[model samples]
Target: MKPTGGSVGGFLAAVTPARRQRDAETLTALLQDVSGREPVLWGTIVGFGSCHYRYPTGTEGDMPLLAFAPRKTASTIYLESTAEYADDLARLGPHTTGVGCLYIKDLEQVDLEVLRDILTRSLAWSEAGGSEQAELTVTG
Candidate 1:
């Protein structure tokens, strides 16, 4: 995905389901704090930093190094190499995963500290050029 130069405030303000909106705000702040990067809108996703990923099939694109979206069902947290986070995920509280996506239905149900650690590690991984890693695993 590409950054749309969209206003993060406008996007968050337009979020439906007041609860989701509130959670999005909290997440936005948390991500920004942890990432130390300004939030950018990649389509509907609020993302921080950027990484260029080339899949095995050579389908490549640029995406946020850390990002999330507030959806009707849950908040989707994007991270790289989720397979490497098994232990961390176990301590993350109620959540589900799909490849690189971490789905959190309720942020309050999880330990914010653990979430912060996970995001921190994930950011470090991306900064260390994880997208160019020889092997990319996302078995979650």
Candidate 2:
């Protein structure tokens, strides 16, 4: 997905050491387990796979889309929205939402089973080219 935010370098500049360390480790393990490929840095706040994207205005683009981030407030997992998973997400754990993303306060507060399920399904949805990045706002 095309990042509508800052450039990769700029984003990286704002990342704290703790956040960067956590994100690096989490993303490394997640990429191996999920996509079986190394995560490519997507602009800034995303570690993604080899997925592609296209906007409704016919602005076609491609990049790794399904990804995650370790924001100051929480760690976010970017998922492709799917109709079938609505109920599952509602019942999964404590979470908030943005335009198209889910916000988990922290991994420790949720069920790993449910989180894994969501991540797995989301990756599938993204691979199928059915999801988009949310216009989310971030705060430290």
Candidate 3:
């Protein structure tokens, strides 16, 4: 499927104007303080980082060091494998999750400290090879 946001604007453009403006401003400030760089476009996702991923099937791709997307239904944060961090999620405020996804009503509802910790861990995990990420998505 085509990415919601076009090339120049990136996925941020796909979100509603108000939400987009809010997320954009938040992301800009966050990245500046944390990652120290601006977000990049990953199709419809807003990503940060210089990391990449390679699969056992031989498919290889690059993604931001960290990334999140604001979709029509809900916002998605691609932190890391929920499988490896199940216990962390349990203590991470109120969140409903999936095999590889974390569903949150909005950024405010979740714990920012825990979220930042996860984001930091996810970057380290991604840099460490991301084998866990692939495993987290595999279903028997």
Candidate 4:
């Protein structure tokens, strides 16, 4: 999927209730700081920067360098690949993994430093074109 021209604030305001707004804002700031880019709303996700990828099937597209969604149940963090960061994930506090996403109930439930480390690693991987090397894994 490709990004749409939506406003980040509008999307956050729409999806996040007041209870979760602070966490969403915190994530936005952290992602922006780690990525060194501004945020863009891609559908319901808040994405920072972008990366281009071409698949083996001769398909290619641009995707967020980093992105996340503040869902009602949890905050979904879009990592480039969770498989490459087992050590980090092991110490990432309370969280779950699904393929490329890291799910946390809220910012308070996880360690921010660990989260930042993960984001930093993900950004580096994306920048280095390591997406194709990613192996999916599921863990909690």
Candidate 5:
């Protein structure tokens, strides 16, 4: 499905409980700072910037440079799943991964600095056409 270009404020308000809304807001700000792009509400997810992806099957679509969803269970961070980010993930504190997403129980459970590094590297990777594999360093 195509992105809807919805309002971020509306989306945040729809999220249940004040904590989730606050979390989403915090994530939005961080992603914006890291990506240097405005936030776009793609359905329920807050996405920053834009990128194009083509699967091996030739299926291609446009996605955000960085995106996340404040779900009931955790905050789902959308990022490219590449080996280059292995080190950053190792220092990200408590989190889970799926295909191309990083799931954190909450902001407190993970290292914000590490998360910022991950977001920065992810944005750089996406902006650089995401063709070459490059390693990144994470400092505490």
Candidate 6:
């Protein structure tokens, strides 16, 4: 739930499948640029910026404003609910979505610009205290 202060390069370099490594690197640069914050490793996730919130049940913790993890099958980018950006995701190419997750099968297969816009908008939403931030997981 905290910065851990781990080496971003160490984690990215260790990612399997060269393609995922490239994608992770690309995402790191984009998120850092969009958030104007250095990337930090929260276990397997590379995250930018930071925020703290408490749920109604009082389970409070901090999480990255934006984050992504290079998975064995796809790149998992964590963000606010896709319901808020249904239009954008439609243009993002072949991908899947979870409660607060965007899964890209191949970074190269998706539109980088669209992905960038999503990251930018997601960061803004988090900074503005997005409605569901309190439910945002700190586990990644």
lDDT of 3 by residue, 54-90 (tens): 5667675555666666665555666656776776777
Better of 5 and 6 by TM-score: 6
Better of 3 and 5 by TM-score: 5
Estimate the overall C-alpha local distance difference test score of candidate 1. Answer: 0.85
Worst 10 residues of 2 by lDDT: 131-140
Against the hidden true structure, what lDDT does model 3 obtain?
0.59
Per-residue lDDT value at 105 in model 6 = 77
lDDT of all predictions, in order shown? 0.85, 0.59, 0.59, 0.78, 0.77, 0.85
lDDT tens digits by residue: candidate 5, 1-140: 34687878888888866777777888988998998788887787888877667655666667777899989888899887835578988988888888788887767677899989988988877766775342222110
Residue 74 alpha-carbon offset, candidate 6, angstroms: 0.8
lDDT of 6 by residue, 36-91 (tens): 99899887889887787677787877888899999999999998787878999999
Q: Write the per-residue lDDT of candidate 1 for residues 1-140, one digit (tens) a residue.
A: 78999999999999878878888999999999998888999899999877776666777677788899999889999887578789999999999999888999888899989999999999877776665543333211
Off by over 4 Å in 1: 55-57, 131-140
Clashes of 5: 0
Best TM-score among the predictions, by candidate number: 6
Clashes of 6: 0
Runs in model 3 lying further than 4 Å from the true structure: 1-14, 17-24, 132-140
Q: List the residue pairs that clash in candidate 3.
A: 48-65, 49-65
Measure candidate 5: CA RMSD. 5.6
TM-score of each: 0.88, 0.67, 0.72, 0.86, 0.85, 0.91
Clashing pairs in 6: none
